[model samples]
Target chain A: MNPLRWLVGRFPTLALARRNLSRATLRSALAITAVVIGVVAIGAIGTGGEAFKQDQLEAYEGFGGTATVEPDVQFEDGNLTNTELSDGDIDRIRQAAGSATVLPVHEPAGSFVQTQSGTLLFRARVKGLENPGEFYEARNGTMPDNWRRTIVIGARIADQNDLEPGDRLRVNVTDEFDRSFEIAAVLKPQGFSAPLGADRTVFVPASEFESGGYEQAIVRVDTTTGSVDAATQAIEREFNAREQLVRVEQVQEQREQFTEFFGTVNQFLIGVGAISLLVAAVTIANTMLMAAIERESEIGVLRAYGYPKRAVVSLLVAESTILGVVGAAIGAPLALGIGMAINQLLLGDPFAFTAAGLRYVGIGVGFGVVTALVAGLYPAWKAANKRPVEALD
Target chain B: MAPEPNEDDGRWQEAGDHATSETIPTDAIIRGTDVVKEYETGGQIVRALKGVDFGIAPADFVAVVGPSGSGKSTLLNLLGLLDVATSGDVRLRGRDVSTFTDRERTRKRKETIGFVFQSFYLIPTLTALENVEMPRMLDRTPTKTRQRARQLLERVGLGDRLDHYPDELSGGQKQRVAIARSLINDPDIVLADEPTGNLDRDTGDRILELFDELRRDENVAVVTVTHDDYVAEAADRVVTLIDGRIRETESRRANFEEGPDP
Candidate 1:
């Protein structure tokens, strides 16, 4: 007899087994539901972690945004402790790489500002007097061309002091340098900062700085440049040719550091997902074992009818696989939706579903199938080895 | 006894008279010589079959009658290939089945010997007709198994009970379904272990009549294990077993006139 035909002929028997499973509908549903929860947990964790990592990578890669430039020097102990960039060197850089924005800037060493209502201590960052209006324009107020008599504080400080764009405040640079100035504007808080103490930044015109030269140059590009890498390379080449006594840092580096940090977190999440899938495998095996024990006599009857050992094993594994498939069919889409929801929550807005990060879905399905297959082995074996006489008795 | 012809030891014999034939061959539908079967339970050996010898031929209806634990059921099991003999040879169609492996024995049982159990071991999930078709499902017969099974059911006076499950059938109807199942493979011999044991006397007599009709028409050898004298009387020949050995074989003619003697 054709083995395939025999198997096909046994469909009624398999249907009988299926019917038996449905006999205790509630128990069967509960068992399958446990498997479903395990499947969903596995898929969601896996895909969710991958989506988060992808989003973080995009943010770090800047998603085709502007290249950044800042000082490479570190300042310490109130002295010109780091490499100083001369105004002439800044001029040479601005002329050499016009593609990059070179904002010749200075920060007042550091100081405290006290309004009549409350005292706010702040570090003063200065934009160049040449085009301070171009870069330092605030959301609430305009930057003053002559910034000696006008200054803008960060949004938080302005809010705390109840100051507006036209409000006048006593700005104490120091006891000898205390001068009353109009609050020209308050700039919006630009999120968290790395160097710390950024919330207390006070913007002033660079020309008012008492230092002989500027500390560093802040450069912003039009983002429509040839490429960020190309622009950075061009600026580096120009600075090297002149052998200028200045160092340039791309803001993209800070973004890259953030990406790397979150990438590790993504790895941890993937590990967590893998562990959940492993646990799901155990749950499936345990449930199948119980099912096999309950139906031992039925299996014996099939054997008496001349069903081969392979047939018994195949039937059992097929049942487990069917359960796994059902669970995954429900779980895969659920995980995708939940993962997207979580991403939206974290980003404060919904993100597009990107097809590039689809490995997570594959991982989920593959894990479910492989885990279910592994779980089926022992139960199938037990079913196959059961003696027909013993089971019937 | 009249000078009986030295007939072919295994050939089919006609009813009412042991009219042996030269053209036909039997080669012993079932022949057991000095078969002994024992079991060990809690360190005590229980001998189920002790030095028993029996011979049955094609178309010969032999009833093995014995009390409980007299090894009648054990002899039927051995003959039906459902169990093996501990010692001695059980030759069916000239082949000693004692050395056959389980798979070989299953194949032999399916193809050459049919079994009707005392409990009417019908597949509960299947209807009467489907249960009849089961043995055919195992066979590689070219005939449409379901059609053949339906004919067998109708033949056993269960034409209308084809779709009725075993649970829905009466005790007698269930045995009729089992009989149909046994004949599905067209086996040369049928081994019935107390087939009517679970039915009432009236129903059991009807079932025995059905078996007798089938044996006469199909010319298939029947070896039934029964403790009931009425059941044994229906057979063409009766073999009484006491203490796990055949005590005597009485001819149907003599049994018809004398009834059963203890």
Candidate 2:
């Protein structure tokens, strides 16, 4: 006995539906293919987005639990002033910080870099910091604890210019103040919280800046320095006691906002994928309607032979539902394979499957089956409601 | 079955109540009282059947014969309970089927009547055995429906072709499968419409023999509507219809002229 026939032996309605769909092999297969495509569209895109988000979050691993302190500028007589924090304020910040590494940043300057193309085709942002070791990791060379003159280049800048440690870079701070500095290290690529506050930036010693107040200060807090909450509170109390003179922006709040934004973006991508399934639903409905029209005489015989209207409806709906289940069963694994391929291509790991991302497969399968059932509803009702008199006539 | 004349002549007319519903035998399995069926097409009321009475009793082989458009098909639809008359009443096994709701009519039809079509409309994808099992598919009685379907097929001389699909079977075999299907529910009456119109005379004779066996062994009544005189000659009763009316009922079997069954 055929397995389908054996399974549906007691339920002839199901057996009839199975046989009917099988008779129109090409049409049924095409409908199933549409469902499969819809499922893969949703699943693969969702999983790929999840992998991308995971890689980004990993980049920000150590960037959290830190805060930045910047002077709140005040305009006096339409002239902006009070832009930088004074040395006296730095001393007070150190006293209130309680072992948190507070590195003062100087004003950033832009200059052209000599590229391997024999021209200054690239620009680099030169940011001065009292200590670069608190924010960045060295990919090639070492970051000296007390370096006063050496500069560290970002990974992207090093890649673009074929520069490494021990390379010399000529810079002109002023018309007459021309100097040379050695490339001490090539730093690893940073995430959203870059040390110099931008991609492809270069960092030098704060002593390079001539006679200037601090532009901003980044306070790194961990278990060693106490909770981030306590650090932010202490700095905020010391700087903004009487008025809002300095702004203390916590990395934790920024991370939360970034997460919310990423979630919205992911939902938008999934919604775009769902439209393909909506189109697939219309195709399935069309297929069922065609089947109904083609089988009018068969339906008439059944109706006339005492098969109730409910049984007729059940048979039609079952045919569409079977298509959905088979399509989803095939599409889900295919989608997962696509997702793994994407991960391997981007993150260098084929098994970098996230729990949230894997759920998209289940979601895709659910949507496939439900969409088919809903699409089949009208066709089933239309076929079942037809009068046996007219159908037989 | 071979187009033989009356084996038992001197058949009674039962109080001369030949073509009207004024008198009915208590053993009658189905009785229609002046049923009138109408249709409105293009806002024009076209009467298909105009006030005609029909009846059947157990083991009776009835043939409703007339030319095309003479309302033979309409009367068959009423007898099968696939439709209701626009006026008058149709009673199936003593119940007024004309007054029944759609669901009730369906249930009554399934239990009381079986249908056989001239074209033998077996589901093309199903094997002969499965086709025979179609009518009993919705039965919740938990019986061995498959085994019963096999037995019915065997009875119709289709035992070796049970696994063949309708398209694979010959016309005679397909009709036999349909016959088995009609008997699946053990219905009280088998309503056949143009049953042999698509078959050769030899095959039609075999189908008539099967009907005769069913009537003799199972006591099941059969009502066949046809324009074939050869088929009409084989029935125990011939109800001639013309112009939406029963022109005459030439019955070979005698019906009681008195009251109900004793």
Candidate 3:
């Protein structure tokens, strides 16, 4: 047959396939549901992992050219213990970091602080910064001087304590030593910083901190003279020269590590999801086999009417392809919606919709159709090879 | 085996004589010579048609009647090209079909033969018109097939039931629709296997009358396989089969016109 005639002949077979599929609606629906679940599993995982990687990159960018120096000790669960940097090390970092501002930081364990009303008390961590103005902006008042007994509190602390710049709060250094300190300022809400959460911390002068050594030092690179990479390398050289076992990391490096980790995790998730799709393939094969068996006499009639074996095979495969396409049509969008909901719940925003994520929708649909076609092969072969006499009987 | 017929018997010659001849007799639409069919069930060979010879002529109504397991359906299947004979040649328009490829055989069946089954095998999902259009669709004739289908249905007295499904029609109506389907492709021969077996006596008579009308008006060869005595009585010729062989051949119509000369 000519190509055009062959193409036209497929119309009736496709129509017959569609009609037969509709005749057995429940079985068709079960097969479609299986494909839907498979597509959704891969799609949602792909989109969710992408959104998480984006959120981490954005958070890292918010730190703004600041590199942190801490003791080379592993911290557990956001808490640092015995991670003290000596004064000599701090002075050396300050000298080596070219044309940059260095701020010493100290965070003691959390202490209990009574509100101005004296009726409520809360446990809060007190962080000491050498130059608080360079790191944080004041939402209400100016930063404290070098040796003053005043403190700058975070927005959450100010809100909970109902304190302004002039309010006096008693600070308890130990069980027997307690002193009243004036609130010099309230810092603006900064969501999260490199080493700690800034929204709920209380900032004080490093001079007023009773600890003899600092916890970490922040180096603010001067973009006018050198880039953050150059300053990081210079600081690393200083630490290497001193034979100190300090770890230096650029914020971008940290972001890349995070992205690589999530990439592996996403691949694993997609692999797990593909297993469900394998089950769906089996479900499609079973459905097609049953349909071929049930329609044995009908197939015989078709053969008697001069339908070739290829036409019969095409008809059965077309039925499965329709199932797969319809399932994907419903599943791809559902996966996106589920991914968005998960993003909003976990990352606090619906940022999961990306171009790459949309591509996953297409990939999921392709996967479904290919799986259905492959699964339909055996049944189609069986249907086509049936002898008309035996099938009619 | 029966002795070969002489020329005075008024039957066409055996298929071997026409091995090099390009032209067939004008009247004979399909002819089967020394055709054999066998089946193997659990390692035992069952010969259904043991060297049966048969021929159908255009514009002739021929009924093949037999008891159960007499190989009447088996001979019909071979003549209709639905099954291949194991030994001898079945010829369509004087050409041996044993040499035809699978595709060519299917195309020949689609273009030259039509069939009506006893159960009225109209596709249930399609309406009467669509059921008749199926063979033309298989032929891949894209133009005016539906119009021809509708006209065939109307000719079969189903003009008012064009859109009715098989399940919605009576047994007689479904059979009429099947007859219309059998004629949709304008084939040279129509093969019916117990076309009236599922109908009442009155309905079966009506269907047989329709077949007679098709043979007279369309001049298409109509062959039926049945055990009904009424069907045999209605045909112009009745060939009786007993135990895989033709036992008797009887002519009912005394005066029949010979078709145009080849």
Best by lDDT: 2
Alpha carbon lDDT at A269, candidate 2: 85
| Native contacts matched by each model | 0.00, 0.55, 0.45
lDDT of 1 by residue, A1-393 (tens): 577545535564454445445555665565556556666676666556656655555543432334433445655687544455677767776766666666665544545566656555443332333455655447688767655668776666676667788776665543225666677878755433322122355665554566656655666566765455665666677765565434555656766676677668766766776677677677768777887887776665455545557667876777666566666777677777787786685454445455533566666776677677678789989977876555654
A98 in model 1: Cα distance from truth in Å?
3.2
lDDT of 2 by residue, B1-262 (tens): 1122122211111223333232344556678888899989899998989998877776667889888888888888888887788999877656787678887887777766888987888888888987888877766432477878888899999999989989899888898899999988777689888889888999998998898888766767788998899888777778888889888888654522221221
lDDT of candidate 3 at residue A13, scale 0 to 100: 72
Q: Which stretches of candidate 1 lie over 4 Å from their true place?
A: A1-17, A23-31, A57-97, A101-220, A234-298, A332-374, B1-26, B38-47, B59-74, B98-101, B117-125, B135-143, B165-172, B224-230, B236-262
- lDDT assessment of candidate 3: 0.77
Q: Count the backbone clashes (under 3 Å) in each candidate.
A: 0, 0, 0
Candidate 3 backbone collisions, by pair: none
Q: Among all windows of ten consecutive residues in candidate 2 chain B, which has the lowest summed lDDT?
A: B1-10
- Local error of candidate 3 at B53, Å? 1.0
Q: List candidate 2 stretches off by more than 4 Å.
A: A1-6, A10-12, A41-50, A86-92, A106-134, A138-187, A193-214, A339-355, B1-26, B140-143, B252-262
User: lDDT (0-100) at residue A347 of candidate 1?
Assistant: 51
* Whole-model Cα lDDT of every candidate shown, in order: 0.65, 0.79, 0.77
Choose 2 or 3, whichever is better by lDDT.
2
Evaluated at residue A324, the lDDT of candidate 2 is 91
- A345 Cα displacement, candidate 3 (Å): 5.3
All candidates in order of TM-score, best leading: 2, 3, 1
